[model samples]
Target: MLLFQLAFKYTKSQLQRPSYWLAVLSFALAISLMVVSLLVISAYEKTFEKSITQLLGQIQISYLSPNISLPKVLSYLQKEKIKVAKVTSFIHQEALLVKNGKVKGVLLEGLPAFEKKASSFFLKKTLNNTAITNFSKDRYGAYVPVLLMKDMSLQLGDAFSAVVAKSMGKNDFNRKVLKFYVKGVLDFGRSDYNRRYLLTSFEALQKPLKLSKKKTSGARLWLADKVFSEELSFKIQKHFSSKLIAQHWRQWANNLLEATKSQKKMIFLVLLIILIIAAFNIMSALFILIVQKTKELSILRVAGLSVTSIYAIFSLQAVFTGLLSLTLGFALGYLWAYLFLLIQSRYFSVLSQIYKLNHLKIGLPLWDMLIIIAVVLFLVLLTAIIPVYRAGKNSLPEGLSHEL
Candidate 1:
């Protein structure tokens, strides 16, 4: 009790000094910066992962032949007791489009019409939400990429011609021309996808691709849990090894995912450097405070207080400062995050055109917060140890003779 009172009195006296406030401010700044940066990066990674996986599915199953029976695959999966969140079938092909005499090659994809209550997955990649809500309603309507729309000078409801090769040979090929109306503009946030992709109904492309209603190019599978993607993919591949191949989403976007991971590591490394500097500031401030209190500590020692008790008093002061800094830092960080979200909701445009998401989300990762707390506390404790040990070791005569 006596030691704590002495520690509190000493800490209170030091509040009038600039060095004390500098230490507190340094810690607070470091904590707040780390929290915000990590949250933003984590949100980016999650959005990117969802956009890619939702478009490609966690696992994709492709047939070895030109087309496979979609019904049979679904039935087989049901019989095999495989759990799936969602499944979508699509037909993909290459075609040439002409608008106003401008020629361009594009990858044409046909998706099945979803129920009125259920929305099509492709809508997530489109700029307009109502673009091709139900392909059954508008069979000839196509979702054109923004890049292609710009290149062809197309507007919504404009008509265009698509030529698909009925048969290909070395010297020549037979082609079939079809008319399609622009219903929506696609924006996947990547120039490569937005430059050459067109989406339409499965029924529209069946005759052109020479496939029946029962056939499809491939099926995409979304799992109930992402962690089981690789395992389920392997199982599905082994089960239908002769007829179909299964691939996980990680296989499709390995490079991009790896790049995000590297980016996160780089961000953490930079923030950690700042944190280390803050720790140094803390050490310097505490050392200075100890020097200024030399005469007071000597008085306590002369009054029969043990060196160990003196050490405990300084330790208490260090802990109090650290806890106070953490509280202020977290409060400031969360306040900033809330204000950012408010701003995002009211007055926001797409922040980055290179990423898949049009909006940003702020996420609080508990594990990350815990890690930061542990690291800061550890650094503070380590920093406090050195000066406290030096003070404990000071001879009574030296402290009594020394002047502040």
Candidate 2:
């Protein structure tokens, strides 16, 4: 009880000093800056991952044989339905879109109706709170990439036509032409996909291509769980006799994922450097405080306090400073994040010029918070150790007579 009272008294004395408050405030500012940076990066990564995964299923199944029929593949997938989340069959082909001899090459994707499976999948994966069954039910609805529309000077409800060709010789060539009214425009973040791709109903493409009812090009499979990609791919490949090629979505966006991972590591390293500097500041402050309090510590020793008790008193003061900084820092950080979000929301046009986002998103991961707290506590303890040891080892008269 006496030791506890001494520790409390020592910590209170430190807290009452302006220099101690300034040190605490500096540490808090440093911590808040680091935490806010981490939160911003983490939120960006989370949103980007969701956008990418929604645009491309976590896995895709393609034909090993170029001319493989879609019906057979659908049957195979149906037989292994337990492994897949959803299957979206699509035909992707290149076409020349000509209007008044202004020719442009486009990548056309023919899938289920814009209101059907594809739209549902997009809503489910991207929007999170929407239902797929509520999408528009227009039979001829088509989706065009924003870049494609911009290149063609097209608008929603504008009529556009394309000439589809097969790989056969000129005599055997069939010209498939159809006028389509633009239903929606997609703005996938990838420039290539945005510039080249168009989406339309599978029924619209099938009849124009004269494909049989049993034919389809390939299927995109959303795995029930991402971890099953390898095992399920192997099982499908073995069962399908090399007629099918299974690819995980990670493989498709490997470059993007790698870039994100590398950037995250760099950000962490940069923030860690900031935290290390803050730790050094804490060490310096504690050392100065020890020097200033040398006489008082000696007086405590003469009043029958043990060396271990003296060490405990200083250590407690250090811990109190650390905890106070952490509390104030976290509160200030959260307040800054909220204020940022509010300002961005109110003046998105102006903020977008700087942040490249419509709104500021700050997400604090629980594991990250725990790790940061642990590191800060460890650094605080380590920094205080030297000063505490010095106080414990110094002779009472020496400490009383000399500056620390």
Candidate 3:
């Protein structure tokens, strides 16, 4: 009781100084910066992961053998009893597009109709979210992303000519010009999708690629448990023959994921450095306070309080300061993080286009918050230990003889 009262009184006295407030501010800023950075990075990763998985599925089963049929691989998957959400077939080819005197090279994506199983899976948000997909039912129709239209100066209902390579001899090829009408314009927000992708139907694509009903270049498999994508991929590789290769979605979005991970690490390192400096500020403040209060501590020791009890007074002050900082810092961090998220969602859609960020979301990761708490508490404890040990080491006689 005596020690706590002394601790409370001491903390109250220290609050009068501007340095104390500055230390608390530093702690709060550091916490807010780190928490916001962590939450933003987490949200980007989740959003991008969803976009890529929806487009490529959790696992892609691609085979080099032209003789391998989709039905055969599906039957094998069924026999293995592997849980799946959806299976889709995809075919893509590089072609030159000409419209309005503008010639641009683009990747043409051929999938089944929107009503069919193979189509753009943009992760529909609502029943009425028609813009999530721009697949046209007409075999002669093409869906163009709006960003690409701007680049090519194309509008809806315009004619697009694709220069596709067709096999003439066993090793020679000829360029076949195919014409189609623009069906719709898309605004999917991903850079690759906007700038490079042209949506076409399977019926239209098969004529050029010479693909039969049973054969496709690659098959996409969506799992009921997306978190186990890597595990399922490994299992597929082990069970399937050397001709079949399974790749996880991360492998497809490697560049994006790697950039996100690297940015996160760099930002974390910067914030951690800031927090360490803030902790050092606390250390300095506490040391100064201990010196200023040495006479009071000497009086207590002279009045028969044990050295341990005198040390307890300072240690308890540190605990109090640490807890107070933790509460304030967490509140500030949460506020800043959500506020930034709100700002981004409400106002930064254009900016997101500049960065190729699509389907960005706001999410709070509990494990990350827990880690921040643990780190802050550990630094607080370290800050307390060094000063308190110094206080405890002062001889009773020396304290008693000290001048105020």
Model 1 regions lying over 4 Å from their true place: 1-16, 27-40, 66-68, 71-80, 114-139, 168-173, 207-210, 292-313, 323-364, 394-404
TM-score-sorted candidate list, best first: 1, 3, 2
Model 2: per-residue Cα lDDT over 129-226, one tens digit each: 23323343333446776667778887766666787886467578767775566667676544566667777777767776767655666777666777
lDDT of 2: 0.69
| Residue lDDT tens for model 1, 303-369 | 9989999889888888777777788778777777767757754786444445545545578678888
lDDT of 2 at 210: 67
As for lDDT, the candidate ahead, 1 or 3, is 1
Model 1 lDDT, residue 67, Cα = 42
lDDT of 3 at 68: 68
Question: What are the RMSD figures for all models against the true structure?
Answer: 5.1, 6.0, 5.3
lDDT of 3 by residue, 360-402 (tens): 5767678887888888878877888888888877776776676
Give TM-scores for every candidate, taking all chains together and pairing residue i with residue i. 0.76, 0.73, 0.74
- Quote the RMSD, in angstroms, for model 1: 5.1
Worst 10 residues of 1 by lDDT: 114-123
Candidate 3 clashes: the total is 0
